[model samples]
Target: MELFIRPNTNEINQVEIENETGTSDPVVVSINRILQQPDSSYFLEGIIYKVPEPLRSMNSEAYTPTAISIGPLHSGRKDLKANSLKPIYLRHFLNLAQLSVNTIVETVQTLEQRARYCYTEFIEMSRDEFVELLVFDACFVVMHLTSWQYPNLDTPNAVNLWQSWNEISHDLMLLENQLPFFLLQSLYDLFAPSQPLLEHQSFIQIVQYYFSEHKNPKLFFIDIKPLSVDDVKHFVDLVRMPNTRMYSHEKSDQRLLWPLNATELHECGVIFRSGDGIEFNDQGGCLQLPPIKIYDDFEKRVRNLIAYEQCHIGNELRNRVSNFAVFMQCLVQSDQDVKLLIEGGIIENYLGGINEITQLFNNLGKHIFIGINYYNSDCKKMKDYCMRRHHRWMTSLRRNYFSTPWLCASSIAAILLLALTLIQTILAVFTGFKERS
Candidate 1:
């Protein structure tokens, strides 16, 4: 027996009525929606983006802001304790600048649309909402940064009074929890004139000084030329600016086929040296890497930076932060590799566990893609050096025969004895030939 199902009469009547009325097709509606969207060129202007899901899934905590939310993307999150303090900071900021709320709000309103375009996601808030968010958040940021410069000078009490400065700094550096640099610069320009300390310094200098003083100054400031406000997208971009100078612009078809980890490279006569940038010395067989001090927040910092590169830096050759992470991931495979790097002064492991450091690098590049890795040529050179038979033979000889003083003396004696025996044998053969003659 076969069973048949009848269509609902209401649906049939609705289709008949729709046909009679010449209702629009679903495809037409979709096309209309597409037509209503902003031009495709507008998307390229977006500098702030949500971290991609694949990367966020690997470590959600690394990308999510814990202490505060700066922009529209994370404004709805209620758990952020610092949200309550934003208003207090804003009030303090107004008092310090002697500007009324309307003045700041009006200033932010002027740039609201441009700031909204800076975000990759379509901000769901109204114009008033966005302008208010920027006013409050930008003021908070300005006050917070000012507090660092003048801790005792009756700045915003709520800036660092309740929240941990480290936590606040970490959240500020997150890619998702960012406002446009232009927005911050605008706010700074308005209020900075009134404040004696910030009057002389540019916004970029204040930002650079705040981060350098709070975090590692050597890592951020040493050998890094100051960047203009136009050069940075946000705090994450500012952090990444120093590394951009080291990226190789040349592209290569070569890929790192057999990447040797830290231990293997060390065994193959590749010396690891701590430097300010990632570079390979082909003649000296030295792999120079920037010294990284790994603390508790180091993974979060690095992961967000890599995420920023994935979203913002279109040219793979320019993704220096991501490339460095990839290079480190390839270099560090195990705890032993971490130990080797630490011994070479290339890594300052404040997190204490060698295994954790190894795991951090191994997982950093999990969902990341590199169209052109900047370190590919350097790795290829190292691989070629490792593959040479003479280098291997010399390394083996040094390890097996000349590793210790006793072994070196014994090997020397053995070589001398062999030489003497050979000379004597030759003399004996000569004498025998003479006798026969």
Candidate 2:
């Protein structure tokens, strides 16, 4: 076991504790206990993390949880207004589960160390405090998700509790403010044990509904496809799960460069139609994008998911959310590109003006590391289409002759003038031949 000593922290005079068998100084005993733990279960890496500085600095507000916090990272902020309500929710859940708060806390205490290991850093809270936090947070998730399951039924506290649903939803999806999925599931099962609240209620359905706008044929890129909840790590991971479910491109490994941006691609005869029913295909580079509305909150949600992927060692193919962000960034360099996408119905800009939407996507991939785009084959295919001689010739003709109104008018006038001259010459020749006769 390794001991990390900070430069200016309390100094240690000796390596080994003087009383090897007996109880030594309190600090020494703590250090010795930590060192004696097995090496195989030392540190669990990449489940959760503080956002990197560059990303955090871009828009610190996006990373901050506004209404509620789930885990230790943002648990006890004084500014959060929802902290007082946490115990109420916990008590409500306890009543539903038919268990006392003490019983639930003790149950959670059993999983304390295991749950602590799920985090990237060491948690500093005592055992009782950790158990309390877990019980409270886990209960919050269960109650929220369960309540959302019955959307049609009006709840008593709906208006007062979730007046700013958007704010709380965005905060929940943040990378750092997440509890492990298993904890939430255990609590949920206990709360809903043998009591079917609805005929076909599911945890996944509740989550999808919570995040979904639920418009017919949802105007956003929500994966309605049923996903196994077992594989999910947290809320951010669950939200991004759909994007990464794309079939592995046959040439996904190939370093296929992203094709030309929107205008250039259009010039090359590559059409950008809205993908109303776009399916995830293994064939890369075919630009099939689900229509998405770019609202003010869009950047916050997307950035959090990307930040989560950036922090973890994740599958390249499964990191489709990050890949999509990078892909969109490559396509949109300016307001004009955003305009093009808007025209194609690929992006519904509800964020008011085009510039804000443009800036949102442009800044998304900054300082983010990405591998070969999952759409490599599609890019290659587009490039090949662009390189076609006929397409190239057509593009040139459009650029040169038919580009402007004046050019079109001048070409038409020249053709008309040539026709007139030829007719006159023919008539003169015929008249001269007749005179000779």
Candidate 3:
């Protein structure tokens, strides 16, 4: 009954619209293309990194360079105020190295690729630009460090430069703002004094000398050992390495911790005392802490060191400073804790209030990727003390009865009154029994 229309032979063919599963999305295609591309090769892993967002957000000022830019990451930051000084310092270095501009440029050009390889990411600059930044930054850093070590031989400009050292030092320790250690060393050796004032002193020693001035001078300068160049990656690393040995390497159980804050520990009858050494030790749970002078820019230095450790992809850096940061974060959880530490001379709170110190520590080590628990034994000791029945009883007695003179007097009066009532009741019962008999 169906009528089929066998119409004209030139009828257009019916086209069906359907979803095409085979067609690739532009994003997918691009990603696949990138995946198919050959991996970029470098002789060395990049040691520097732009501090990630989580850490930067916590304290934006800590990661931002305030005075100068040392390397490519922050090289052309618009806000950098020390650009004018770089060329001046470079000129001084040229005078010291005794190498012509063309010669220094050529030497750096040769090592340009290797130096680039030291960075973790591909630098977005031309070959000329990259080489220029490396040569300029390296020379500036080397010259700056050298001038400090040989102050007697310093130029007028060098002496003036020292005036801005507080800012310069902060800039140098930044995670993103760093040059390769070898590059600086090579530059240093090329221009080292004909008759060196310090024969065995290397660039690391010079750096240690400059940066360590803000730290406990007794610990930083006394019998300070020279660091080998092979393991160090940059100036920030050089700064971090000296304090790595501060802590003992003893093992501790994580679960067995004296996790009490300072006030609580004090309440638990634990004494807070200053540590013997002039620096904080990360040894397994040993409660030794060096006196910390919390200057205005202290957090910036500590944050940058931790960020560098987090960015660097190996145990070569050992993550000791970041570990110390984590340990401190764990140690100071409240304002009361800061007060206890201050009383103990373990923390010199120059930044003013207890809350400021608390926030400073709490904000640190958030991006600490490496896991190191150095205070396990110290925590365990405190935990054990807290768990003891004798300590608990004493603490309860002191808190309940001996807290103040008024409370003590009230408690004594109540006890005496109770005794008198019991005596009267016993006498009345005995008298009643005799009358009944």
Candidate 4:
């Protein structure tokens, strides 16, 4: 029997619909939308970024500003009590500079688009809101920096303001809580010419002086000749300058394999000395590293710095802070390693226990890719130096026998007794031989 073949209704309807209207497929439309979007270079223009999930999840509080928010990322938070001081500081800045509010507003408005481009996220605030925020935040930052010199005695509690300043300093250094350095410079330049205190000082110099005195004392030792204000991205980058300048970029294909912990390296006759950067002397079996000061906020600062490097720095060779973190992680495996580094003066432990220090290093370098480690060659040299059997034996001997004065004296006495016993045996043998003759 011949059956009438029925056409597939859905396919026929789809074909008819396509023919009736000039419409692209859903996927084609999506592809076109994607093609119209900007490239990676557009995103690369952004200096400010939200700390990625892999890092943020590790320590949320480290990346989050506790005291205040600088830029749009953490703006309008009710919990941040320092947000209330922004308007007050803005008024103080205007009064000090003898400039009208419209002057700074116009200045910020002119650079609004440029400032917005600095952030990776799409800022939800309107042009007016964003501009006002910048003016208030920028003024607050300048006043905050010089707050130590110009204490606000008008406030009922001067002591509380001082405490808030310390907290705010840390908050300003956070990766997310940052304004563009150029915007800050522009604002500072407007009033700087008139102020006697800021007459000779550039914004960069002021920043250098403030951070050096308060945040990082080691900044005084770092040669900032290679750094310029134009090169600095933000406060996080400013903090990173000393580290980036500490080491020259060297590429290596080798990875650090079998990295002995600090205590193990010490046992293998490898000496660790605190210095400006990571270096290894094969001849002397010495490893020199800058002394890492572990304070309460040290991990927070380091995490933010690492997060900045991860987001901004494309080249691993230039990821000095991240590379250092990786290197430290390799050297610190346990509390013993931390103690050894502490005893050797390689690490200054201000956070109380060695376990915390150990955990600090161990927690770093997670969920990050380390390419072209700066200390690879030095690590290899150290590992090779440690491989020698003689060095290990000598180190063992010295550590075991000469570790204490009593042990050293006992070792000497034992050696002398063995020598005397051998000499007495020889003398008796000679006498017996002579008597036989």
The TM-score values for the models, in the order shown, are 0.83, 0.81, 0.76, 0.87
Q: Write the per-residue lDDT of candidate 1 for residues 1-437, one digit (tens) a residue.
A: 11111111235544554565577575644444444445642456788888999999999999888888988888978898878888888887888889999999889988887787787776777777778889889999987886777774345344456747688888998888999998889988988888787667888877877777654444534345777777788888887765443553355677544358998887887888887666777687898877788888888887888888887756433566676777788899999899888888889988877888888999987888777676777777888888877777777899899989999999999999999999999999999999999
Model 1 shows how many backbone clashes? 0
The whole-model C-alpha lDDT of candidate 4 against the native structure comes to: 0.76
Q: Arrange candidates by lDDT, highest first: which order? A: 1, 4, 2, 3
Cα displacement (Å) at residue 230, model 4: 2.2
Q: TM-score winner among the candidates?
A: 4
- Residue pair clashes in candidate 1: none
Q: Where does the lowest 10-residue lDDT sum fall in candidate 2? A: 1-10
Cα lDDT tens digits for candidate 3, 1-437 = 11112121121211111122233464544444334333442323557677878888888888878888888887787777776677887887777657799988888888887777677656777788888998888888887777766876466755455467778877787888888888887877777754367467767777777876665443223234666888778866766664434555564445523266666666766655565442322222234566777878788877877777776664643566776777678778899889878888888877888799998887675767645555566565667666666766776787898789999999899889999999999999999999999
Model 2 lDDT tens row, 163-265:
7766666778788898887777667666666456644666766777777742212432365578676676777777776532243354367675775777777
Candidate 4 residue lDDT tens string, 1-437: 11111121245545554555556585544444444444542355688988999999988999888889899999989999888888887877888788999999999999987787788877777788899999999988877765554344123364565466668878887999999999898888886776777667777776776676554455213457655668877887877765544575376777544367888899899887887767888998888877777777787888888888888766433567787788788889999888788777878877887788888889897877666677778778887888799999999999999999999999999999999999999999999999999
Clashing pairs in 2: 284-378, 285-378, 285-379
| Global Cα lDDT for candidate 1 | 0.77
Which wins on TM-score, candidate 2 or candidate 4?
Answer: 4
RMSD of 1: 7.8
Give the poorly placed runs of model 4, Cα more than 4 Å off. Answer: 1-41, 149-162, 215-221, 242-245, 256-258, 315-317
